[model samples]
Target: MANIQFRLQSSTKEKKPISVRFKVGRKTDVTANTGFSINEKDWTETNLPKKNNDVNKLLHKSLLKLQSFLEDRYNEALTDSTVIDKFWLSNQINECFERVEKKDTGILANHIQFIIDNANTRKVSGRNQIGISKSRVKGYETFKKIIEDYQKTAIKKQIHFLDINKTFVDKFTNWLINTRNYSKNYSGKQLDNLKTVCLDAEKLEIKTNPYIKQIEGFAESNEERFIVTLSFDELEQIRTCNKITNDAHLNARKWILIGCEIGQRASDLLNITKEDIRYKGGRMYLDVIQRKTKKSVTIGIINPYVVDIMKNEFPYKVSTQKLNEHIKKVCEIAEINEKVEGKKLNPEAKKNKPETMRKIQNFYPKWELITTHSFRRSFASNYYKKIPTAVLIQITGHSKESLFLNYINQREDKDANADLFMQFYERLNKDKEPGMTVIRNAQ
Candidate 1:
């Protein structure tokens, strides 16, 4: 067993430094600085601060945490039969306070590499069998590449942890937006990943810039961009278009129609197989587990067009990148060329050339805006008015009604509200007796 207590050092009439005294067995005793100070009158014999203010509250919390950490270290050392001397106790205290020094102390790039390696191979704590997803590993790799590029092009030198001050953060953000041409949301995500890495490094006793906590990342405002979704007429036009002759284009069109009807993500939509479609009680249904959410959904196959596709061969194994490209080409050929406002990367813009970066509000042809994801948006938007919101959320896997509504871009229209009010009124009056009608006079 080890005994630990907080004590005050000898001083004059002013404040004195506080220290922790540790005693293990009868032969070993040591004292380590708590790195805190207070007036002699402000501390009580119970080894707790007596002041009732914010500063005292913070000191109290730090002391409790330090005590807990030291006790844990002491218990672990006991099991290993480690030396219980003053030097060992001092080293433990230094580790708790993150006072260790190393030759590679604050290399930002090295810390990022550590994070990437850990994310790639590490499992969630307490879940020994499950490792992190490959997508997350790729995300960390992407952020590492961005940092390396910035270091080479902008700074021309390696960045240290201490170099990540507010000025550096601001410059990096500007470079991401103006030079890299990244959207505000995506830039924010990258900055957030960097922040996460910094935090993990700090936990591992690595010194870092204090100003990292003071920085704020960019966020997207609702007014900055519009949520684009295809209307019912546009989807109908794509379905009835006769200009498509190429087999690849025809396959892309069929997949788009299936996606709009099923409302699953492209990752899950493109992987559907004939075995996933089942016949139950003489009705066809799609049984699928969403790849992203892992939530199983059973969709009734009622659309004749979708049934016809299923009767033949469905879900042609198309790569997501190729699907996006082919879908845009199919939409363009169908003459779905209405002008719609959205965001798109400028083809001619070169990174590191700020002059070529365009503002986000440039309108483009809707066919050019169509991607693999547009089908899901089209399905959610077109069917929301016809089905109950809760039922639709079950199919779309939306956890909240507001989020589902926003995803479909379905704001409350005045005509729709009036129709709902009339339906409610009719329902309420239908149960009334025959002579219960009231007459009103017009002014």
Candidate 2:
């Protein structure tokens, strides 16, 4: 439901400017002038043009049409969760009236929408669609909300692309970090999105700040990387758990074991089907063309439990989100609750409010940190060195061994390397006297 009204704020004998007030869900109530005027005496009690004359009746019909148009537009905005304010409302009025003076392409919100509108069909390399990912679209919307909140609370005005400069960024960053209590990584993402839209505007031949190119994004330090993986023993605990009776939990447990043995990303692993499994030379293999990197990989299913589950009842497809949730519950039931370093939901944060609970870093129960990503990291750690690094890299779809090694917590086997060197020396000295230069003996 929408509540949009066009009325004069003060009654007078002379014609008064009609103001448009738009409100939805008690969250927004903004006013803007409609650029239509009428004397207060000419209006009916219902705020329509008086029906006493033909001109007034025609004016009433035209106003009704405009009202219907605005209502339809508001419905579309509500469905898309578009950020709305006095400026946005005013723009709608201006657009309906066909006035271009107040319409500025420099506005950040307008430019973002311009990009989004075109993104639906934007193709990359004539094959894949760009900016069509739900995560990316939702991310841009969230970024807009952050900036809107910033302006509302701190600046009390709309910001434009040309307004983006060193000074504006300084205040924006400070307000995001100190005032809003947002993390550097999250705030940096918002800034990065702003830079992206500004660049997009430039490509459209729209004017933008000259310093937009100088704006840089940031990330967390490499040393502070948060890694969460289940060990072999902990994974075994989950495997042996018998308390899970819920079908959803059972389905998630199967995915956890299969994902760990296969060493694939959530997107690729969750897309697994019975048809993807193949039998080659008496060995079971699951084939996948990696979605993110578009790499072809065939992973051997060696774990007996995984092989059994795949053979018996292939997991009914579960969403990535549902799998993450159910797996945590399964692990908790198996008593994998050791306190470890990870991020968890903030206890004090308000529910249903994304801005309230940013992130809290502290030691949480092991099960609390478990996610779909944990299965991949767990596979790498649990079988490191037991399996050839090159083979594992292929299974994981990593481009290089170095990149694969950095993803897991396992250390290099220096002892095994020494043993190999000793064996080499013994073979070289076979059936011959070893030559050694003897120095002074230590006393």
Candidate 3:
């Protein structure tokens, strides 16, 4: 009895089905029935002749298909008894499809967040929630902490919009550079993440964003050019430490070295298993998904030396942070003596103190301001010097050329530049050539 019948509204003589319209629950959706959707509202007011047979038939079929699709989706949404879950799922799919129909916008961050959150609630609710894996829950905790910190900091700067204005964006850029001392590329990435969150918020009506301006760019940092990457000596130091030490702490050091070789984040490397590696095409490689970006990343292990070390250290399960600590210890043992950040231990700190104080006092290395992330940066820097930029970007999953270059550039290599210029002058003056003068090399 429902007026849910599909009818073709185009010319009856036209053999090709132009459009089909169906009515449902005070609303209508139309399709070309050619595997694409069209707005029925546009066709409904058309002045086409009513006696068009071909148009009528196509319209009827389209209505039926749309009705069926909606019915199925509706049924799926209601299969669960939880009203909140059903409403969330149904609304998200409907909104996404509606946006698609209108060709309104590109993939928004809020849409992705909706899907992820819905998946988590549906999959982990009830008794099963208690069984959530430690790794996944830990990742969620990390994500929560980041969001909390961002919100707290950004709110102080009046950046509460779901989508930020250009002014706030510029301020954030300055904050990262002048305040955080982040390199240009690093600051860009952090801002990019903020942009993603804003766009996601836009989709949820939490913010208004359709940033009219192009993303801001920054001048490249000269200091980045001088960053020293891990040399063969550092790798040897790590490998030797692993060979001599059999404690769990030492095993963590071994994994950290492997992490450096593969150029993976500590979190991603911590989750690695024997299954992630494959020996194919006469070479070995790791197939991994970056935890932060959820992007697929693959890395080849060409160095048989590092490969051997990984194989030797296999079958050990350790926390990523613990491995970081052990790497610092190993660095100290190797007389690398570079002060790296570690957790500060206040042996007498009361349990009643602020939770922040509970954090293991970070090991602040006097010579090197190092953290777990340095291993990843060191790996990228080491490879960029030895490999082509394009190949390195592919391995590291870096989308921006500037970022890829910045990863390898060291800031402390000012002396190297001076030395090069010195050599150039010396060459110019040699043998009294045309542009030659008496050149004295620096002692």
Candidate 4:
């Protein structure tokens, strides 16, 4: 039972009637009478009958009523603990009644359920709802994977819902940050979902929240990792390799090369047909609106190298996955040893069996590295080195300078800087003949 307190005293104020008094906590203070003081001045009795009465009479009656209330509460407090439990149950029922009376069930599960149901409804609702795109849904699916894995361990027999504790959160965060190596933003998203679920749990009274203080770090790490962009010579090797004999595939290679020349995401390139090309305002260009960001991007390539690839290549429906494979194969044939991101089409190698690990994507775990996105990263890094930041921003549709700079490969920067230093050293040595020492005249 809760620690009980009741204030009972007579008010000397004229015309006030006796009233019952009860207070729950230090926050709730009571006047001498059963009536509560409105702020610091007037008092109103809760138990008084509806009537027009003077202020003093009201105070007196309210105080008397308060004394009665205190006696009742004190008597109940002295009763058996089991009886107190019964009283609590009754109070909860009364609270529910008050909730119904107020008609404020907007935040109930039924409301969310209704919204979800309506979103699923065909035509009228489905099309009208703020829909998540297929790409966004794919992102959500990835997020859902983490949620499902977390639920498997966090849920317990005693709780109908997930028991969110510090341990569970710590594990999930570690899995994302250390194991999966997801960025802080992505990890925060998983935590956000957990927080929402916890709030829902509170509403349903399924589980009590213990980790109320979880706040994922907003401070970004100073560690700047970079992608490796292919050098011009390496790109030339891949482009002109003799290994590709299939005309259609060779043409696809041209498109891939064109994509490299003018940085465009694979998703955007997959839908690019001849119709998107335009010759307007005295220059030829491809007007592309990016699928991921829905940002408008235009590429103006007057170079015959790119135009020749575009013109000679017969359009083919090359899947991004297949394109990545061909690029890898072409790179291998050209003796290009640079790392490019691509996914493995093979299943996870069986533990303790090297042969089984080499198995393809069908049998068990499917893990692929170097996905198609690497090409985009490579392109951005490569061009940002050669072009001005402002011009690159226009072609790449990067709205911010930081975002544009983020794509630059740090590895490439290191290599380029080293090469520059070597060239400078060579120039200095050449200017001063290595062993030619003129006999210094005594001056």
TM-scores, each model vs. reference: 0.64, 0.66, 0.46, 0.52
* The candidate that achieves the highest TM-score relative to the unseen native structure: 2
lDDT (Cα, tens digit) per residue for candidate 4, span 326-399: 65555555666644342232343424332232222222111123335555666777766466556777777777
- Model 3: per-residue lDDT, tens digit, 1-443? 12333344454443423333333354433333333333343344442223346765564454445556655544543442212222233333344344233222332323333434544453432333423344554444443444444445643211233225565566667766665444565466656556544544555565354462355555545543334335557767666653446586566566657767888777787778878888888788889987655568888887776677655557377765666566666666655665444344344444533222222424455223334666677788777545655676766678766776656653344355466667768887787747657989999
- For residues 1-443, write the lDDT of model 1, one tens digit per residue: 77889999998849899989888778768887777898877888889787578898888788878889888978875654455655556566666776645335476777777766666466454445445666677788888888888988876546667667776788899989888777888889888877877777788888777877766666676667566666778777988999988899999999988888888888889888998989989889998887666679988889888898987867578998898889889899888898988987665564645435454567899888888788788888888767766678888888788788767666655576567668879999898888766889978
User: What stretches of model 2 exceed 4 Å from their correct place?
Assistant: 1-103, 125-131, 348-350, 385-391, 398-406, 409-443
lDDT of 1 at 52: 78
The whole-model lDDT of each prediction reads 0.78, 0.78, 0.53, 0.52
Give all candidate RMSDs, comma-separated: 15.2, 11.5, 17.0, 14.2
lDDT of 3 at 273: 85
Candidate 4 lowest-lDDT run of ten = 359-368
